[model samples]
Target: MIYRREIDGLRAAAVMPVILFHAGFSFFSGGFIGVDVFFVISGFLITSIILEEMRDGTFSLAAFYERRARRLLPALFLVVLCCLPFAWLWVMPEEFRAFSDSLIATSLSGANFLFWFKSGYFAPEAGEVPLLHIWSLAVEEQYYMFFPLLVMVMWKRKPSWMVAVLVAIACASLVYSEWASRVFPSANFYFLPSRAWEFLAGSICSLVQSKGQKRGSDPLSLLGFGMIAFSVFYFDETSPIPSTLAVVPVIGAMLVLLYARQGTWVSALLSTRVFTMIGQISYSAYLWHQPLFAFARIRSIDPPPLIVMGALACLSLMLAYLSWRFVEQPFRRGERRLLPSTRSLVASVSLVLAAFITFGIYGHDTRGIPWRLPAPIKEFMADNDWSKTCLLEGSSGWDAMPIENCIFNGSHAQTYAILGDSLASSLTPALTKRLDGMNIGLQQITHSFCAPVADVSMVPHQARDCGAFNAAAIEYLVKSKVKTVFLAASWKIFFEQSRYIFNGEEVATSDVGQRLRDAFDKTVGALTSAGIRVIIVYPHPRGDTEIAAKVAKLMHKGTPAPTITIAQDEFLQQSSPSYAYLDDPKDRHVLRVDPAKIFCGREAGRCDLARDGKTFISDKVHFTSAGAEAVADEILVALRQDDIMDGNGVAALSSD
Candidate 1:
């Protein structure tokens, strides 16, 4: 098989935009489609080789796997090796653990499963793990593992019938993906079964050689190319991804791959040297780009400016070149090399060992390694059972609590109350700690993402059920006769609108803050009027990184002492603006709490809180257990003692 420069150009076309999109350039919103583009190209290339081998009666499974290992593993292993220090130095404990888990997953070609359980590649938390890109490799590798054997089995038996079988499978997977996108979105999005059709489509293209099939007129290719280009430019994240809508890019890629050779200008353009170079190292480039962008974003403690992002692009290209030269080129080129059988045995055993080692490392926190939490600080942070009261997001029995029992129980504890949204629930560890100390039994009634805002101004969503649930929660909160109430939420998320898809449709809506403010005011007013003590725990300072990372830093330094703290002002200066939309002057009943000073503020604006300089907020807003405790230690005093007698420091509510 001849090397197609045009294919390389196609590779360049596919990778550049994905790099740009990840770098925060909003212009290439649809640049994510680059993965789909790569998928199509891979199917064509790999299938072409397999078919060639099949025709010559030389397609041995052993040789096929050896070729795959030699072509893929070296560069990948190098990338993983390079990331170790960066991960240790920059990633917090929780993130480090996640990275370790992903490392194990990637080594074993089970990254697709890991990522499916973890969430989408675009999820904010996902950017922290360096091994995230391996999911794609896993998908492709899974395809290679079985696709060739399936083709081999069918090739002689029913050459024509195989296409129908594959097409049927692809169609079925598409239908399953579309449904799963609604029901089990994470599973559907990350798993190979849902994504297999894209590769299979390309396989179909390879099976039907260009000379044998209908070229369909020159106009068809033009239309296909135009559709693909249009998709790259016009589609945004809100577009239902890789569902039925994915057909546009897949079909367009198929068209371009099919017709590009037949003198079409689009094909000629894609065949250029510049494009070919981009394609040549597309794999390494893809692998390196995400970690670079993610690290830069973490270090800046802010989103990367355009200039910094540009520098990252240059850095990525250099890394890609280095990887391609040293790692990729050497092993892939068949030289005076080991026999295929020998290579296969070595590769298989090594992969299996890598999997076992990785799993062992990630199976426990700190890989089950024990270390001390600093003396005085250890006492402060100790004595809290993390799981007894605080509920894990997907933990069993969390949401099953009866509505009547939704009150905090540490005091004269028969009455019930619930407060806040997801952020509030995170505080359960801290809340449970204090409540347990007081010997009070409290029932926590909570919703995962919905906050109990007082009004009905929504950002307009297609999920009427979610919007209705928000409404129902508010009504329930307002009507419930609990003696005391607590309020919390990621106030930042409420005001900001995220552009995402819902069941194959594009939908964008404002954050929940504005829509929720009125209800907040009314709820507080009503609770206070009813003579029920109501408390609004003002949000803690937002950080740019995961909370676990910060705690991990402290843990790793061999200093378990709580002497060091991050500055409230510095964190606010850097991250509060992103969340400032929730700060409305009209809402006076809301109490304010700034735990940023408690956990991160020993120095002026410089938090030596973490062993490293990495920020500690996971993704953008949620806190890990360590982060939540740091804040809880500061605010819990005020909460438990009733020091905040009223909305402010002034004595508005009497102990009488």
Candidate 2:
């Protein structure tokens, strides 16, 4: 109904943190709360306008939707269109496939659902997605599409009943969100029902304000602003979004919107030129930052230094201003000649959507357009994992593993087993190859992300029954007369998360860490007591970025297929848990295999990631066939040094 420079200033407030947060600036840890702030502001502002229009009998759903399409689509399509060339040139095949999926989903206003499904604890490839940020916009757009019709239908009711309905819906959604935040955190984050309460908070604000609710005083508005600032600084990625914790920022925004009227101190401050200007271009600013940062990350071998990211953040704003000036304005505000009429605008939108959908289908169907890469790069990206079929990952744990089949020779004397997560699976080809004709058999019992340790996990998690599976393996090994077992995994990967569950209580990883160590010790004790020889393969060095993609990008850009490496000392420092067990001279009964002897070369104290022109790491942490062979050689050397080896050079139980 009326322009509020303060509202524009608040938009500036919301957008800046989101930009900085995505840029990986540490100080902006709670910066993700900015989206919550925007949700509240949008609900308030949009509801306020709809109510004003309906009161004047001038609200047309078509006009309302046209304005929304005008306000949003031009800048959005422009951003996605600009990202296409870079995505074609830079994104690796797998990541490009995901990018195409997001492009299609965004065009359909369903990116949130697509992203929700793709999310997982181990989804490292997600960072490469430039369209990842569009999930929020989808949530917002869904609200815009639904809420106006809701208000229009309900407007004919008595005032009190209308307010009551809004209140009931908000309460139900808020209650549901709180519960879902614990059980379905990812879905809660992306789903509309869980996030609807935030919009309702603002909707209630508009209703009360239009009914002559008193303007907020200086103290109240200032407190509102302070709460917003607190969430921005104090919250973090671990914070449960849309839960009761979100009430802090939601109420903060509600207060600022309701109380910070024209002359109020908070309003005066927000009305400043700098904030208003950024706020004016905030939509475009929000759209531009993610692609810039993601592409920069995709290109760099290392995490881009903050200064470079900082420069890119600033560049996003400059581009935002330019597009806001030239592209967004002409399509949204000018003589209407760009589309000329609503029919033409709808046609143009549908055609553009079809084009993106076709492109996405092509990219996805063609496996991220393999033709885009040079033939040699395609060779580098080829399926290098020796055999994926035998890996007992996902729900296929102890029961699903075909123990007797994967073995080199089950009919031979003793059958040994290798057990752990995907890291262990990655090492299997070489290990199985080495053990093929060793007179004894080698079996695979590995499952991806299933911790090798016993008695602990992120409980109630949607993963395979790791504790049950591991316990079964122990029982199976004893029952099957398996005398030797190889234990390996990316040990530190589990503790990288924020929260864990142990002993029926919610606990921090600090508690989980101790339980992990104890669990491993308990597992070893169980095995050794059964007269089974155990070889614990220490974790290999992990690259900081997606090593395979980084290598491919470099080679694709003519970097000569160079050697890639990471600091050995740094890797060991992070891997102290595995080292502590392996390094202990006091415990010599349980044998150990150190992969670092092969992966972490002594040259300059850095772990060499490549043996020749080709990098061996398949991704950030998993090994390619060559890398697996290197680690397997270390395991072979350890076998040679162990008493398990017979004098004839075949590995066996010394007792046998």
Candidate 3:
């Protein structure tokens, strides 16, 4: 196959936006479309190469795979190896284990599947994974594994029929992508089945170009650039990508491949020295950028400053240039041989695979090398069992009820209900302890991200039926005739943020806030009408710091812990909106509890996250076991003061 300088320029176009977007630039919100562009480009170039080899009757699957290994593995393995030391030093144990899992998966060309099971591509946790970008490479490699064989089997057929076959498969893949984006978004984004259509678009472009078709200097190439530019500028995290909307950039790339020929201005622009140079190193640049950004994020206490991230982006380019000149060029040209023969490439890959597989097993079996940290830090870092057992997740709704070992004093006549998202779930440990041996039964109904407010939709994360889940919990509470109900959530996230991802779209916080208020009003009204007392737990003091990690870092350094506090005024200001709906003068049965008031001193005007040398909050918001106990003690005191519970521990309502 001939070299296309214009193609290299297109690569530069694809990589820059991705780098910028990952660097947290708002302008590059739709910059992720660059991956889609790369998909189309790969489809075109790889198909073109395969067709040329088939026409010459010299195609061999082994030779094709060897070339792929030579082109991809050297730089990729170099990046992964380089990331190890930093991951060991900076990443916490569980996260490091996940990184090890990704390393093993990447070596086997299965990172896409590993990541699909882990989290969404755009999730905040993805920013901490050094090898997260490898998923795309894995997707491409998986496609090529079967794609070449399928092409060779059809090579003897008429060209038009082959193109028709490609088109048909592309259509089927696109339909699947559209449906999957709605139903299983992470799978749609990470998997090859939903993504193959983009590559097939390029395959069709290759077929058209092979037929010697030409529309000389036509303006369609310019239109193609415009469409790509539109997607790059306008698309965002909320876009249901790889769906029909992805057609814009896929078609744009197709147009460029088919029409941006010699003498066309688009081709001339792409062939410019600067664009060509960046394009030349685009592969190395892509390999280098993510690790640099991810490490920077992982090592920071707060989000790295924009200037610092900008500097890191420049450093990534410099590193990419060096790798391209040293690592990539030598290996591609076989000037510096890592293996003596072509067949040795397989041996080298196998060795690397075995090493990573072993590392993954050790990492998992040892639970992320727990000996690396002090026992206290390791204990703190470990996920509390309550998170899994007490918290209900997914679309199962109320079917996850009757959480064994969760319901306490079940045989007692007096029943108290705890309801809300994970914040409410955190209360279970403390609530169960407080009511122990008190002859009071507890019904805990908790779902992560599903607030107890009725008829409000949680965006991007929760199912659309979250409102239905809340309604069901409410019905269960009423039917069970629970005497008191407690509700909590990370309300600041919903009411204070400027925007939120909802149903694969960004919605204004104001809109969701209004809906929340409406739901809260209706929910409270229903509970009060049913003669059940309602306790609305106000937002707790929180900061941007990860308290557990911060404490661990302090312990690692063998230094006295630094004070971690959030100003009470700031906390109140942030949480004020959470209670605004309760200002209605007619509201009677609902009572509010401010945890900050009990947790922090009025004179200090700040809430301390660490008390007597132990971290109270786990992350930014959820309470630690001790912290929950403290809050629960205060709640019990309030219950007694309000006469909701009598001196004998029976509900005051027993006489009503």
Candidate 4:
């Protein structure tokens, strides 16, 4: 195949937005479509190459694979090598193992399937791994493995019938993508079958361009570029992806490829040195950017500022250029005189096998660190032995347990009902400490992922479990003499446009606020009318980055012990703008607490190792047994202010 500067220009078009978007630049939200564009381009170019070779009877499976290895492996191996020191130093034992396995998966060209089963592409866990982007490369490599053979067979049997076979395969891939996107979104996003249609779109372009007719005039190419530009700016992460909606980018890419011939303005513009330079190093740029961003976030426990992110982008480009020049170009020279094809193939296969063997054998054993803890902190985390604690009914089952477990157990314990979602459950260890110390009996009930926001407008997934669990818990409260009901959960997840109705009704537009207020009133009234007081518990401030990153940093530092810390007021300030989506519901019945002041450090605004010479928390969010005991003073103050707790803990105690 002859070189086309326009093709390189097209590459620039596809990759720049992807780099920008992944860099956390808001202007290129839809830039993720760049992957789809690349898929199409790969399909067209590779298919064209295969078809030409097959026509002349020069197509050999060995040769095809060699070319692919030359094109892909050199740069990829270099990337994995560069990540070694960082993975060793910065990543935790568990994460290091996962990264090692991902490295093997990438080398074997099966990373796509591995990632699909492991985590969603957008998942914080998956995003943290340096090799996450290798899934796309795996998809392409897997495609080449089968596609060349299929084309060769069909072309030999019937020269004119290959198109029909490819069309059928493309259709099948599209169907799989559409179905899987709904059922297994993570799988749908990563796998080759779901992604093949985009490539097939490009393959069809190869057939079209080969027919000796130009696609259209300059107007069509300009229109295509316009459509692509619009999509890149407007689309976002929330958009249902790799589904029918993906046609926008696929179509735009086809148009640009088909009509971008010499002398056209579209071709002239895209073929410039600046754009062409970006295209040449596009592959390396894609590989380098994610790990850099992820590592920065892991180290800081916060995303870098835009200025810092921009600097990283510039650094990525420079690294990409170096990789392209030194690593990629040198390895791609298919000079059999120096390194025979057989030897090169054996070496590549050996490297791939070594990576796989090492990862598989060592993956699990990598995290075999011993758990040694100080006597006190160890007691706090593991106290109330799992064997002895009144294990709630159905806690082991898929069905949710009631909200009664949030209370304490004691002779004089008051009637305090606990309710909320998983966030609420995570807080149970801390809450239990305070209530247990106070000699209070507790009844805790909670449903997984079901935050206790009464407003339908706030809830997401319109989760049936939330509605059912709350309804049953309310019924229990109405029948019992519960004096005070304590409500706690991750409130931010619910109170936003993120709400999705399972019933399929669009959010009620005119009365959304009123409806929210009414729901709150009904929820509160059900308890209060039954002579029960209500206490709303807001969550401690949290960083948006994955929690594992924070834990891993401590592990890397070889800490003698774990520490508990609260986010600073300044950190809270940084997060507050996102909270406009979360409307805080503070009523006379609701008692709010900003524990950061008492729990966090004075200067850093972080939860300190010790507060006033007293250890306040065990970990970042959960309070230590001692910390929980200390919080009894604050809990009492809030309860007294709300007049929910009586002089004696009798009514509350009896209710429990």
Q: Tell me, by lDDT, which candidate is best.
A: 2
Separately for all candidates shown, the number of backbone clashes (residues 3 or more apart, or on different chains) is: 34, 1, 0, 26
Q: Regarding TM-score, does 3 or 4 come out ahead?
A: 3
Per-residue accuracy of model 4 over 352-459 as CA lDDT, tens digit each: 669655755575464412133333333333441111133233323224333323345645646466666654554455566666665655566665655554434233
Question: In model 2, what are the clashing residue pairs, if there are any?
Answer: 216-259
Per-residue lDDT over 45-92 for candidate 2, one digit per residue giving the tens place of the 0 to 100 score: 889989999889999999999988988999999999999999998888
In candidate 3, where is summed lDDT lowest over 10 consecutive residues?
Answer: 647-656
525-631 per-residue lDDT for model 1 (tens digits): 66666655555555556644444434444444554432334466665665464345334423334334555445454555565444342223443455546666666
Model number with the top TM-score: 2
Deviation of model 3 at 284, angstroms: 1.9
Deviating ranges (above 4 Å) for candidate 1: 182-184, 214-218, 338-356, 359-364, 367-544, 547-656
What's the lDDT of the predicted structure labeled candidate 4? 0.66
Error of 4 at 406 (Å): 10
Provide the overall lDDT of each model, using Cα atoms, as 2-decimal numbers: 0.63, 0.80, 0.79, 0.66
Q: Given candidate 1, what's the lDDT at residue 649?
A: 39
Off by over 4 Å in 3: 175-185, 214-220, 334-337, 340-343, 374-404, 407-421, 435-534, 541-546, 554-559, 563-590, 596-614, 644-656
